[model samples]
Target: MFSSIKKTTQKLINLGFQDDHANDVNQKHVVNFSYLVFCFGCFLLMAMSLIPFIPIVFFVSFICICLAFIGLRCNYLGHYARAQLLMPILKMAQVTLLTLFYFGSESGFHFLLLHVIAYSFIVFRADQGFTKGIIVGVSSLLFLMCAFLSLKGVYLTESKQNLLLVSVFFFIAIYFSVVINLVMSRLKSANQYLRVLAEKDELTGLSNRRKVLADAVNIFADSVINRESCVFAIVDLDHFKKINDTYGHEAGDFVLTKVAGKMQSVIRPIDKVGRYGGEEFIILMPKTRLPQAELVMEHLRQTIASLVIETDKGIIIPVTISIGLAPISPEVTRYEEILAAADKGLYAAKRNGRNRVAVSPDFQDGN
Candidate 1:
């Protein structure tokens, strides 16, 4: 039961469902839900207008409802970026003007207009201070025009010449809340992108050593609680420095990228693979026993052995990997202990002969 729960949780993490990984996935979900709400509002407006026998207003509401569905359809069809840019702008304009027409100046509908102005500014960047300034200037000009028209009895109710007063503190509080959220969300997204860069190898696009170590700690914790074994393997390409010397470093880089691709292609999704150092990669497979890990590594070795590379000189080269694997023991309490055992087995493979898999001394069969 615990194992099943662990597997489910791991699946969710892999799917980027956690709050820490919010920036990684689900960008369109919020927008889609918003659009859905707007569609419902459109239908509600249509129904409410029909009760008043308002044919023209009902027609407008029907058109707005259709446009809302169009937005939802675009979102569903994967045109998420376009939907985000266009839908809210259209909806805000439509709702603000329509509500204003129905209810005069002092109606709660003015709050919707306030929200539209806030939306315009919030959707844009705070860095666009000039653009924001222009929007604010235009909005204030329009409000002044309306105030003048209120004297001329347009878009206004009875008392607007004396009703221009507003709760300044309330507006300030709401605007501050919106601005703070926007800033924080932008900062969080930027940090996530930077963190992803820090955790990945630029050349290979695989996890860096730091990320591998982080995964190791998590895997160890899981192993401890679940009593599930994990395997760590140190993989080093044979004669990599020689390739760099004979060919240019570019050709060596070419080989490294290709080898990284191959390693990534052959591994299970649950495994963590990374460049441990120059010419050496580490593989960690949680819930894997030694025998299965060995078979996986052996296949990787054979696959890489037959791997052919061509330098710019039209010279062909074959590459092979030396792998040393060790399964975690119940007595082994630290991640480094498992890593050190794997490293020891790695040296043993190098010493006895390169291009083979070696099991750690303590984990050797019949021990």
Candidate 2:
């Protein structure tokens, strides 16, 4: 009975081991749950604070609580995008306006209003800032005026002149918030673009060696649980220095770009190709086996051998590459071991000839 139960448990474990797919799904669920809990907490805080304000505050708090609960539940139950989008709209424009009305714009809870504009700034960064600015400016203006009127006891039945003044202030606040968020969003995008360019090789759109190594360390961590096959191939341009001397550095750059493009074309969607150094490029193939990886490298070799790069002298240069394939199974532990093996294979390919494919002996038995 013990042996039978152990076997059954092993089967169950296998079912749960969906490799990388399971990890992605579980992490997303956790994020969704956390968002729900946060929204619920905000609602609870508002309700507790306003419960003592007779029937008027009590009724308003009750409605806010219901809306919050609905948003929380929806977010928790797989309607993630809908919940994220709808909750801010409901909270900021609907219940939030009411909250501002009771507490005033200068109330301690005024910071909550910033969340709406901030979320918009991040998610809608691509949208026209002028348009978003107008929308937020208008929304803030309306919110501030309503709050002012509510505090002055002219909210429900207001004197016309007083209402006009309140409306003007509301528009001003909205306009200011929109302008601030738009500027912030533009700055954020510019920084991100600059960072990407800094880490990338200009000639070949591949990551520089520094970025490649950093990304490799992160990828290795995921390999522990996923146990998926990872193949690392080191490719060197044969006679690269000769190409540079014979044709010039411009020709060499042309060869490099063409090689990088060929590597990108042959590799699978999940694979990554990066410029490792002067004439060396690294190809990282995730969840791929030796035979599948070899097929890709072979294609890269042939593609490079066939490429016609246009140089500054108006000469079309032809180039070739030598590739070394090193694969690690789930059983492998050390990242360095995989890299060392690939390097050895690359050396072997260089020794054999300028244009050939070499496979590491360590990964041969799939041990």
Candidate 3:
């Protein structure tokens, strides 16, 4: 039952928005606020209909409903500025006119203008300072005007005035609560997106150098304490600069992204792969010795060598990678030492030939 209600609510919130705007946070917020206005307008119209109908009160409720429809239509047409402007205007008019002529100050209708002021800040972007200030100033002036004019006389009986006072206050409290909660939820989602951008490579979508190094340090420490084997390898694309110069930078980028994906697919779940920098990557294999790492790196080298990348101009480019492997030793005191050993082996592989894996001399004797 709860799931059905949630789906129905989602459909209403997405009403009138195009499918392309499904991920737009600001657009969703506008639709939700407009829907709230429409619902409240309906509530007021029904409540006034049930009571001893005053023509003025009924007229104001009907106008509120009409303005809400206008707001929704503006948002649907992508006129966000107009829709935002309408919301404050609608609230200010409803509260001020209602307080001035009928409900009066005793009914607390003027307090709803506070919501109008708060809504302006939430809906307007930070760059819209002038527009936001104008909305705030106008709403404030109208609030004071209602308070002063309401002192003249109230049309409703004392009992009816008290009941309306409670209802208006309750509505104001609920509106502010929902607004605050929505703001907090959006903030959390934005922070999470920022964290991912900081730690991951934008182009290749792999762990970046900083994150990879941090994880390597932690994994290395654990391996030492637990007496487990760990292997570190540095992989570099062979003749990558020539590929960029011959085909084009776009082709080079495509090759890099595809190679990263292929490496990820071949590695074990316990292994970690990251983009160390331009044309270079790092792989960490936990609980794997030098001989075991050699087989894995050799498979990766063959896999990359077999890759065929077709460019936009219909040129086919073949790619290859050279790898350097270093295993954790008792003599290794820090993660940097292991990394330096791997660097040495990478040079060895490059010197001998490309598209091959080379093991560090320090580990060759032991393995």
Candidate 4:
């Protein structure tokens, strides 16, 4: 039973002190909510402590709860900076109140001040008025002075053993908060890196096959429903295998990377390009007609044919791509249908002699 209670208490602590959004407006709102909730708990504890006749507990808890509420209100009203600033002030007030109850800073309440200083650094980040280093240094010195005075039996008349135990509790709380914040920050960064890897091709840095296909399907569907025009294309390099055989696979990779970069440079931001498979690239252009797509593909083909790749061994490799083009329409609602239609025209371009653009017959049929 005691272990279960301990676990529940730990979960509550973790929820209250998360350290991600002190500087972000939306995130600050969430942190402010957490602070308000923690202050509510403090208010409840104050009610229980009232019987001990220590009026400072009730006074401090009341002030903290009011400040927490004000911070939350400020965040909701788009005053996030104001809300974040309140946290440090609230912690300072709490420390002062605790010191009064303990008779002096020498009563071991100085540890709570250290916790507040570190908490400010975690919450306010660089946006605060003072630097974290200065706040931490000053707080640490104050805590050490209080500790020295306590050792000499200055001011605080309460039991020395009890005050020592309170300092230990404060230390544990502050230590855990810092550790949890570091772990969470690392996890957030790692997740962002993994997301980029999932959506991009490793070699060319173009959209990977899966991501491109998914986006193409959505764009096709939207165009179909809205009666808008979109062109689907398949671009295949001519003699790609022969290039790999003569110049080596390294040259093949170099060719693919350069071609992808060239395509990106020429294409509009509204269009999407992706590596469909080995030696095959896919492009989807929204708000484009058959004639416009033909012109774009022809220009791309001519530009690629003009690019000269000179190997270190002095072998000049001239590359060109055969393009297949088709427009999305009522009959071409599915991405598979569009891809298949473009692919058919692609093979036709190869048959008619590589380095040209071919459009599906259905495009002329007005379907």
Best by TM-score: 3
Winner on lDDT (1 vs 4): 4
lDDT of 1 by residue, 293-351 (tens): 98899999998998887777888877888998888887798999988988888888999
The candidate with the higher lDDT, 3 or 4, is 3
Give residue 39's error in model 1 in angstroms: 15
**Per lDDT, what order, best first?**
3, 4, 1, 2
* Clash count (model 1, backbone only): 0
C-alpha lDDT (0 to 100) for residue 298 of candidate 2: 89
lDDT of 2 by residue, 1-367 (tens): 9999756643432232231322233323222332343345445545544534334545655665577566556654656555445544654554355444554443323344554565455433344476447546755765565555445332232343344345435543654564455446546666677899888988899998878877676666666668767788899999989999998887788788877887788778887778988999888877777888888888888888888777767887778889888887665677767778888888888898769888876676643
Error at 319, model 3, angstroms = 0.6
lDDT of 2: 0.64
Cα deviation of 97 in candidate 2 (Å)? 34
lDDT of each: 0.69, 0.64, 0.82, 0.72
The residue ranges of model 4 lying beyond 4 angstroms of the native Cα positions read: 1-106, 109-185, 365-367
The Cα error of candidate 3 at residue 280, in Å, is 0.4
Screening candidate 4 with a backbone cut-off below 3 angstroms (N, C-alpha, C), the clashing residue pairs are none
lDDT of 4 by residue, 164-211 (tens): 557447554755564456447656765776887898999899999998
Residue 305 of candidate 1: its Cα lDDT? 91
Which has the greatest lDDT?
3
Q: Which residue window of length 10 is worst by lDDT in model 1? A: 160-169
Per-residue C-alpha lDDT of model 3 across residues 1-367, encoded as one tens digit per residue: 9999767766655565643322356435644664575457556655865567677777777778877787878777777667767777777787787788877777777888888777777777778889889989998988888877775444777877777778877777877776777667667777777788899998899999998998899889999999899999999999999999988898999999999999999999999999999999999998998889999999999999998877778888999999999999988889999999999889889999878999876777644
